[model samples]
Target: MDEAARRRWHQQHSGSWLQLVATLRNEGWEAQVTCEAAPVQVEGTLPSGERFYFRARHSDVSLGIGGDDPADIAEWEASESHQEASYLPAAVGEAMIRRLARRYLEER
Candidate 1:
């Protein structure tokens, strides 16, 4: 689907996105992302729950990076701790988030 379509789909399905997060953790992905735009930071977990968070400086990136592999998640290599502080929800379009979640579910 195109970007615009994806955005609409994502916005309309908030519960689906959250469901994916829980499913990920339960199915072994074990990572949940909390996106906030004010400060531009996205924090989530890895399979082992090794606190992982990254700052999104640009809209061109962050969230999902579509790939040939349905299970291909964006590679994160940063060190920040969300294990203590909390932030607002990210302003990122749900389309991206939903896209990733859909792919994960399809392959799950």
Candidate 2:
């Protein structure tokens, strides 16, 4: 994504993340999201006491599940980081994040 596109994607993705916080909370998880800045972050605690954490900046995302287990943590970013990952088109990156978030919530 070019600078303009990246900015757009960041805004769009950040908005989507914001919208998710409410739905997630309704699912019995205390999903709180902070997307006002780049590298939006979200952390939640499931009703079962399981912890969930998510961080996304542009097309790159890192997730933590199962608490403190290194094996349970994963990062997926086609471009690696903000500078390198800017190549991902906004639509593609947005779709990826949506899918990933859905799966995470469903599994939880």
Candidate 3:
């Protein structure tokens, strides 16, 4: 994507993540965010009692959120945690959040 498209993508993706965090917090769940240099980390417990950690790059804006399983959480932590790439489309980001929310809520 071009510069403008990239900026829009990042804005949408980051905004959605922020919204999700806020929603979770509003529901009385504990959420924490650490905006570091490259990979911005948002780790918290969902209302369903499952813990999740989302990691995304601020530059390229590629993001992934999944950590309910202990093994998955360990793997996520072991990974490079810094994959800079093109920003994902807003639709893609929203779809990811929807899928995660559905999975999280369904398990409750």
Candidate 4:
């Protein structure tokens, strides 16, 4: 993808990313955002000390929790906090798919 295509792709994803940030903040997560532009990144910590990291890019998005203490890790391992997605909906045109693939390869 060229520069123009990359910019367009990132712009297309910005709204959903912003909505996600707003929802997280509303849920009482103290969030620190790296940027509001393309490839939005947020690190959040809840009152209970659970930490969350979220990253959204035009090609992909990821969410992860952080726990470094040994006791906390053990407790979490024994806890019933696992979740499975029954369905994840995605709509991608051929051009988008191509762009995603190109971005993935470039990042790697």
Candidate 5:
């Protein structure tokens, strides 16, 4: 892709991460996001003192709580500490963000 296309793609992904951060904050969690490239990252702290994280690149999304030791998102997902973390094809698009946010609110 050209530089322009790459920037557009990054912006799109960053928008998704920002949406997730906003949703989490609206739901009472303290959330923040960083999107320097493909894998946009979100970190949130629940009212109950739990640390939550979310990372996504393209169609791959990973969500988990704790284990701040990972060097990167992929490592975090692969770590045994977050055994439940896994990628799903359904994790793409706006709808997936809503679904994941709902699941986070419901499950966490």
Candidate 6:
């Protein structure tokens, strides 16, 4: 992504991560924030048993949103500290979070 687009994505993704933590915490789950970089893989399983997997690098802070397993969470968290610094505006971050929250809620 271009610098501007990357910044926007970072803000949105960061916001989404924060919202996820809040939601999980409200639901009585223990959540923690991290800033490491970890191998992140997302997969979708269809009703027909078809599965799709995507591999990527993700920040630890972004991975704390949800998961039942603590080990997996910690692994993600441990990778956070190595990420590059972020310099996006707070308002942009907030807006990104709100949009992500809406999308996440709608998906549920």
Best model number under lDDT: 2
Best TM-score among the predictions, by candidate number: 5
Q: Rate the local accuracy (lDDT) of all candidates.
A: 0.42, 0.55, 0.50, 0.44, 0.52, 0.37
Give the Å error, residue 68, model 4.
Answer: 6.0
lDDT, candidate 1, at 95: 42
* Candidate 5 TM-score versus the reference: 0.51
Question: lDDT at 106 for candidate 1?
Answer: 58
C-alpha RMSD for every candidate = 12.7, 6.7, 6.9, 13.1, 6.7, 12.2
What local lDDT does model 3 show for residue 86? Answer: 30
Task: Give the per-residue lDDT of model 5 (tens digit) for 6-95.
Answer: 788767656665775677688778878754345555666655555666665554565565545322432223211222223222234235
Instruction: Assess candidate 2 and give its TM-score to the true structure.
Output: 0.47
Candidate 4, poorest ten consecutive residues by summed lDDT = 79-88
Q: Which runs in model 4 stand beyond 4 Å of their true positions?
A: 33-41, 55-108
- Which residue window of length 10 is worst by lDDT in model 5? 74-83
lDDT of 4: 0.44
Worst 10 residues of 3 by lDDT: 74-83
Which is better, 2 or 3, measured by lDDT? 2
TM-score of each: 0.33, 0.47, 0.43, 0.39, 0.51, 0.36
Task: Flag clash pairs in model 4.
Answer: none
lDDT of 4 by residue, 1-108 (tens): 999997876675555545555665676666665554444455666434656554445545444445663222311211111122111111222133224333433443
Expressed as tens digits, the lDDT of each residue in 1-97 for candidate 6 is 7999978877776666566546645654444334311443333221222222222242222222234442344212222222422432334333443
Off by over 4 Å in 3: 1-20, 58-95, 104-108
**What's the C-alpha lDDT at position 89 in model 2?**
37
- How far off is residue 56 in model 6, in Å? 8.1
Q: Against the hidden true structure, what lDDT does model 3 obtain? A: 0.50
For every model in order, what is the number of clashing pairs?
Answer: 2, 2, 0, 0, 0, 7
